[model samples]
Target: MHPTIAAAEGLVIDWTQMPTYNTIMSVAAGAGLLTVVWLARALQLGKPARLEGYAVAFGVLGTILTLTGAHMTLTWPLAKYFPFDNIIFGEPSLGFGVLLLGSAVLLWRRRELPETEDRARELAAVIAPLNIIIVGLGLALGAIAFAGLIFQLFAAPPEEPISGAFAQWPWVEATFMSGMFGVTGIGAVLFPLALRGYRAGAPRTAWQWIVGICIGLPGLGFFLFGALNFFTHVGLIINTMGS
Candidate 1:
């Protein structure tokens, strides 16, 4: 009854009874998948000098992850701060994923030239201001979250469980705390720089740097967290399910 592939496919556990480590890693995997997909699409679009295409798609991916993660009990700071729900149903997350994916697909379909400079200019002008606003907001909020995480590292424990697994494995707490900063920090900082490079299109120096910082480092963080979680807690998850 271990949580092997078959077990995961067929296992049945009440939502409320699921452990915190399982929820954290599961949500991380989903979010990471979205990031990878968006990164691939961005690279393809950027090759054709379609910076706006990539920007819009990347924005959609990030927007969905941030807003949806803030709502999901597994990933949200609110879930830890409040007490109403632990693991909300996955339907809403799935719906948002589909909406963002569909948006990306539509953008991909229209990646070719519009045959009119006026049209392209109009779209770029509109998106430029929006990009600045979105990236600015992301940076501000990420800084706030990073600060909160730091405070938690040193503060007294709450009577309620901020992270249940932290009691058993302190690394679990670090995983969530550092992972949040890594994900959000990378996105907020690197994205604006990437967009600027995308727009410049001259020395062609920005694209690789953008991809490296934005995708590579965050990806490494996710992979590290996943490895650590598996090594430290996968057996526990399997055993809990079997029991």
Candidate 2:
């Protein structure tokens, strides 16, 4: 039996064959593509309404879709391989929920403001102070994730089993994922507004660029990595269908 087919059906005893895993992956990839477009549009300036719309949609609806797709991917694994494990099921679920809630707040705030550069600057004022703390926390989390990954690479025994590796390091994966979201989804997306605020002589302080750079670097890295992954998934899907 193909590993993909077996893993796809592992949770369902009654189903002889299931394409659930592939379907979920496909959905996730679709949502991810939307997110990429949303992010791109949000990054552009000149039109305030379009900018706000893209930001709100990307932060709120886009993240929601991504979370749903992630949950679908997690379902079979949780039900089959790690039924007794709480962290495996809990971390990503809870982390994504937090991300969604944060996005909701951003959406609500953006909706309340009028579509104008002044209005955008005012919103950036509101975000500038909060960004410092959030980006600082994101950086700390990123450092910890890097440390963990280094340890995993250098310290793990040569004889350690390769199978179920992700299941074995649930916290590491969860923490890294959380950091990635914080840096890319929250910090990177919001920092542009901070830059705008600085340009407009708004509430942003001079030193804020340091925070932006810290968060932006990781955000770019995550974006590139995700792009690579997305293309890889696309190639896999194409090959699968061709066969």
Candidate 3:
């Protein structure tokens, strides 16, 4: 089973199947634009509107989708045998590319739905802050993603059937995916809690509880992940330079 093979798509291809044109642009646009829109709303820079909320939500999702596609690309070297190889190239563009573009376009087009002051206040006082934080973390993740893109471009081509710890390391991929899940998974676990929070009359607070856990606390995990990555990389650099 080729790691790049897609039983879903019914064919296979290499991870570097094509240039990063479509996938990279889509992901980056999602993260970067959405982050901007969210931060603006959070800071009260614009009129209270659904566009702001929508932007942030799509942005984080875009960032996640891009990360998934990017990681899947690593299978070329990492895979013992990629099962989805045929599907990778045969079907179409990289994973979720078209859907993302369509969603972004639709989101942009549908920004002006009629709503009430009550809803505006709710978006402003509640979802903006939390969504801002989520989008901001997404922006950070997108930046880290550049490392992989650079590796694909400037670094020497992997040894045919690339070897070394990187080729075999599942933890690297798992860590990235886990980080994304930990942040958004809260929403899945606490949908009813979120609805309750929304309905309980959007009182702004330093912490919002969702599904029995404080939202602010779970939110901190994304920052912690970034700090850990920075220090780890810095330590590795210092050790290498010393050697």
Candidate 4:
């Protein structure tokens, strides 16, 4: 067993409320993904008219993620079973949430722009200077993803009861979660390049495609996983009650 779970062996938890965390984080991830998709489409079509809507959506999602992530990071609420989860899930969410919120403000301020193409250029220009920070975040995420993958493969292996129905297919659960991290890492690493390409009027560029796929896939996965957990958690509650 993982050390954290081992440490938390005797503690009783209310599984019913656990899904709330999953739901909130997943919604934030999904909304952010949708925002990115919309922004990409707008940029591709050179339409800035709808940028304000995207900005509003991003701001809301970002706020939700930021608050939740901050609380998780500071409190380490899951320390009992998965302490590292605080770092793996919380830190990235916080960082990315702040980025989204900031970007929303920037986009909102420039909503009067006539062309999405120009907006992209301006955004790219603003972010270009932060390449170092972006790269650092990418590296951190990559390291976290790699570590999480290793832990999932060799440590507890997700066979614990917390895995619920997935307890039988530990490797699948491991791969799915780790894969989400890996893709999100890749997206962060390639984000600057993708933005630069988009700004240069190359919406169809490879970097852009790769980044979009990486980010969008994880977004969908988080959303689906969270949604699935809601039902699974209810089943768990029923089973516990029946027993």
Candidate 5:
């Protein structure tokens, strides 16, 4: 049996915890759903379907706010680097991710770039930053979740394995990894391809592919990862008692 703390007229029990894994999972799931929504619209005959053109403009702005918060978590309390957690810094990458999406939208709307096969190779340069965001986020989230899982397992007595599709451990790597894996990577890859198609004079179908793959996917992924990170970690946070 795990140990419990004593409290006035009550038992202060500490529950097992796992948050990193959960966050990543949310990120991934959100990305997945968005992907599906965009795909369905791509097949339409008219102008490509969109989540909301102007609304998506907030993509860049929202990313900036989010990155700011994430950076704070890493630097101050989270201490995710030297003298603290050694996982990785993903804030910059997410910034780049938004930049990629924003830029692509701008390019598509304006139709400034000339359409040519040769341009495809050159255009890749524009998309490189986006890919970096995807990789950086994926790796960082995965590593952090893994680290959290180890911490949680060691924090308490180990439980025997139970039969089930999923284990109920407070920390699990998949949760966070799922989050990181969401919009950024696959979307990063697909966006450019679709954007490249658009630049190459491809139809709305091509552009929709990019939007579906990128923007649509994030909501679900973030929600899932956020839930995992929040619920699992809350119990382990060492809450203070009011006298």
Candidate 6:
């Protein structure tokens, strides 16, 4: 056994027995997919009522993800993995959840005003100022995704006991996860264009389609994976961390 893994034997938290990790991932997945759909609707139809519905959805999912992610990030429940899992999963989940929650609040506030009827325009205007920050975050996510890919592929192959049942598939698990991260990174990088197109009232813009696909695919994957983990993670935790 690796010295790290050996040291972590009895100390590692068993995520399978608890719903915390699964719940967080599931909420993140829901929020991600909802954001993509909301953006699509905002870009295409720009319907006020529909957009407001999405805001409510975001508020619910975002609150769940934000609370769970913040707890995981702050408390570091999975202590064996320490900062790696915290950085790769906890921090991003917290950040995106907060973003979603904030957007929901902003949209909800706009809806309360009698004069602010054009939600699409309001959305575009609200996000435009943050384009630079969004782009920077995109770049950072891309960098982290790239580093994760390399680490998964070379530094920590699935054959390592750490992978548990994933080792049975060799590099397949790593590839799928890395691919998800890659597409999500691409979506983030191109999201500014979608915002720009919305601001310009161009519904059929290429950026919308591209970003939608990029974000939607991973959102689905994460949702399904999180659901699956509800059943499979017990074996994984035991196999990798030992009983």
Tens-digit lDDT track for model 4 on 1-243? 232221234423344323235457876876687577668756765664566887898899899889888877787555454566678777777877887898789778877877624666676777676667667777887887677667664132232335544555556566777777778778878888877656534447888788889888888888777676666555544544322
Model 1 sits at a Cα RMSD from the real structure of: 9.3
Cα error, candidate 5, residue 85 (Å)? 7.2
lDDT of 4 at 81: 49
Worst 10 residues of 3 by lDDT: 153-162
lDDT of every predicted structure (CA atoms): 0.43, 0.41, 0.37, 0.67, 0.41, 0.62
In candidate 5, stretches whose alpha carbon ends up further than 4 angstroms from where it belongs are 1-46, 49-57, 60-67, 70-74, 78-129, 145-168, 171-219, 224-241
Candidate 2 accuracy as lDDT: 0.41
Clashing pairs in 4: none
Model 2 lDDT per residue over 143-172, tens place: 544644454421211112231244445454
In what order do the candidates fall by lDDT, top score first?
4, 6, 1, 5, 2, 3
Prediction 3 global C-alpha lDDT:
0.37
Ranking by TM-score: 4, 6, 1, 2, 5, 3
Which stretches in model 3 have alpha-carbon errors above 4 Å? 1-57, 64-69, 73-107, 115-187, 196-208, 211-215, 237-243
**What TM-score, to 2 decimals, does candidate 2 have?**
0.43
Best by TM-score: 4
lDDT of 5 at 209: 60
The list of candidate 6 runs beyond 4 A from truth reads 1-23, 46-48, 112-117, 153-169, 199-201, 237-243
Across residues 128-192, which tens digit of lDDT does each residue of candidate 3 receive? 33444344443444433443333331121112122112425534544443444344335323333
- Residue-level lDDT of model 6, residues 68-104, one tens digit each, is 7787788754545444665666666777777778778
Error of 5 at 23 (Å): 9.3
Number of colliding residue pairs in each model: 0, 0, 19, 0, 24, 0
Error of 3 at 222 (Å): 1.3
Each candidate structure's TM-score, on Cα atoms with residue i matched to residue i, is 0.46, 0.43, 0.36, 0.81, 0.43, 0.76
Question: Could you tell me which residue pairs clash in candidate 2?
Answer: none
